[model samples]
Target: DQQVKQNSPSLSVQEGRISILNCDYTNSMFDYFLWYKKYPAEGPTFLISISSIKDKNEDGRFTVFLNKSAKHLSLHIVPSQPGDSAVYFCAARPGSQGNLIFGKGTKLSVKP
Candidate 1:
C-alpha cells in the first residue's frame, strides 16, 4: 500500500505565480508532517512542517496545511521563482520514532 501519495509527478509555473502541490496518506499513526525541497543530485532539504496538533505552518514563500480528519496535506509556494524549481517531497513520521515515510515526489519547474 502507498502510505503516502503525491498525485502529480510534475508542475510548471510562471516566475511570479503560485505553485501548489498535494499529498495524501492512509496511515493514521502519522502525527507529524514535513515538506522537503530537493535539487538535482542532492538530499532533500527541510522546508516547512506541521504537526497533527495544528492545521497550518508557513515560512517565507512556503506554507503547509494539514487536515487530520482527511489524512491530507498540501504545500503552497507563492511568487515562485526559477530558484524554486526542483523536486518537492512530502514526508510524515509516526508519533514514536522520527523516521519519515515519503511520497514519490513532485517536480516543480518555474519559468523565468
Candidate 2:
C-alpha cells in the first residue's frame, strides 16, 4: 500500500479564494510532512511544512496542518491566484530517513 495518498485528484478555485488540499498517510513512523507546488516541465518546489510535533505551521498565505492521531494532513492557500495554478504534492519523511514519500499530486486550477 502507498504510504502517502492524496484522495482528490484535482481542485478548482477562483482567484482570491481559498484552496484546500487534503492528504493521508498510513505510516506512523512519519514525523515530518511537507507540501510542494509543481509547474509543468519544472520540478516540485517546496511550499510549506509541519512536524508531527506541531498541529499547524503557517507561512504567510500558506499553512500546513497535521493530525497525527488520524494520520492525516492538509494544506490551505488563501487568496488563490491564477499564478498558483499547479500540482500540489503531499510528502512525508520518516523520522529516521531523509527520503520523502510523496503522494500523487492534486492538480489545482485557480481560475481568473
Candidate 3:
C-alpha cells in the first residue's frame, strides 16, 4: 500500500512566523519525495523535492527534509505570509513513472 499520511489536516500560523508540516509514508519503495502547494480550485504546484539519496533540500522560503529510516518527511516555511495560505500535499514516487502517491493534505492558514 502506498499510503502517504499527513497527520495534521490543518495548521494555523501568524504572519511572519515559521510553519512546519509533517508527513509519513508506509511504502518502503518510495524513494523520491516531493511537496506541492495548492490553492482552491487549482492544481498543485511543485514546491521542493528530495531524492532518497539526500536528507535535506531547500529553496528560499521553503525547505524539505526526508528521513528514509523513519519513512518520514517535513516541509518548513519561514516568515509565513498570508499569501502562503493553502493546502500542501506530500508525495512520493518510486523513481520510474514519476506518478505520485499523495497524502490527504494539510491546509495551512497564515493569519495576518
Candidate 4:
C-alpha cells in the first residue's frame, strides 16, 4: 500500500495568485516532508521541505506546512506564475531510511 498520497490529480490557478497543494501520509514514523516540482520530460526538483519538529518552513514564494497529528502536509505558492505550472509531488522520509516515499503528484496550471 502507498504510504503517501495526493488525492488531487490537478489544480488550476490564475497568474499572480496563490496555489496550494496537499498531501497525506499514513506513516507516523515520517520525520521529514518535501515538495518537488517537475516539468514535462524532466526530473522533479526540490522545492521546499519541513521537519516534524516544526509545523512550517518557508522559502521565497514557497512554504510547506506539516501536521503531525493529522499526518498531513501542504505546500503553498504565493504569487503563482505561469512558470510555476508543473507537476508537484509530496515526499516523506522515514527516521531510518534515507529513501523517500513519494505521492502521486498534482499538476498545477497557472494561466495568464
Candidate 5:
C-alpha cells in the first residue's frame, strides 16, 4: 500500500494566482515532510520542507504546512508563474531515518 498519497494527479492555476497542492499520509510515524519539484528530463529537486513539530514553513513564494493530527500536508505557491509548472512530489520521513516515502506526485501547470 502507498503510505503517501496525492489524490489529485494534476492541478492548473493561472499566473499570478495561488497554487495549492495537497498530500495525505497513512503513517503516523512520519516526523518530517518535504516537497520536491521536478521538471521534465530532470531529477526532482528539493523545494520547501517542514518538521512535524511545526505547522508551517515558508521560503520565498513557496510555503508548506503540516497538520499532524490529520496526517495531511499542503504546499502553497503564491503568484505562481509559468516557470513553476512541474511535477510536485510529497515526501515524508519516518522518525529520524534517512529513508523517505514519496507520493505519486501532482503535476502543476501554471498558465500564462
Candidate 6:
C-alpha cells in the first residue's frame, strides 16, 4: 500500500500567483516531509523540507507546512513563474534512517 498520496494529478497556476500543492500520508511514523521538483528527463531536485518537530519551513520562494494531527502537508510557492513548472513529488521518511516513501507526483504548469 502507498503510504504517501498526492490526490491531484496536476495543477496549473498563472505566473506571479501563489501555487499550493497538497499531500497526505497514511503512516504516522513518518518523521520528515520533503518536496522534490523534476523537470522532464532530469532528476528530481530537492526543494524544501519540514521535520515533524516543526510545523513549517521556508526557503526563498518555497515553503512547506506540516499538520501532524491531520497527517497532511502542503507546499507553497509564492509568485510562481513559468520556470517553476515541473512535476512535484511529495515524500516522507519513517524515521531518521528509513528510506523515503514518495507520492505519485503532481505536475504543475505555471503559465505566463
RMSD for each of the candidates = 0.9, 0.8, 1.2, 0.8, 0.6, 0.5
lDDT of 6 at 28: 95
- The candidate with the higher lDDT, 1 or 6, is 6
Better by TM-score, candidate 6 or 1: 6
Clashes of each: 0, 0, 0, 0, 0, 0
Off by over 4 Å in 2: none
Clashing residue pairs in candidate 3, if any? none
TM-score of 2: 0.96
As a whole number from 0 to 100, the lDDT of residue 65 in candidate 5 is 89
Instruction: Point out the worst 10-residue segment of candidate 3 by lDDT.
Output: 94-103
Best by TM-score: 6
Q: Model 5 misses residue 72 by how many Å?
A: 0.5
* Overall lDDT per candidate, in order of appearance: 0.94, 0.94, 0.93, 0.94, 0.96, 0.97
Error of 5 at 109 (Å): 0.4
> What TM-score goes with each of the models?
0.96, 0.96, 0.94, 0.97, 0.98, 0.98
lDDT of 6 by residue, 1-112 (tens): 8899999999999999999999999999999999999999999999999999999999999999999999999999998999999999999999999999999999999999
lDDT of 6: 0.97
Candidate 4 structure quality by residue, lDDT tens digits, 1-112:
9999999999999999899999999999998999999999999999988889999999999988888999999999999999999999999998856799999999999999
- Judged by whole-model lDDT over C-alpha atoms, candidate 1 comes out at 0.94
How big is the positional error of residue 20 in model 2, measured in Å on the Cα after superposition? 0.3
Over the stretch 2-98, how does candidate 5's per-residue lDDT look in tens digits? 9999999999999999999999999999999999999999999999999998999999999998988899999999989999999999999988966
Better of 3 and 5 by TM-score: 5
After best superposition, candidate 2 residue 33: deviation in angstroms? 0.4
Which residue pairs of candidate 4 clash? none
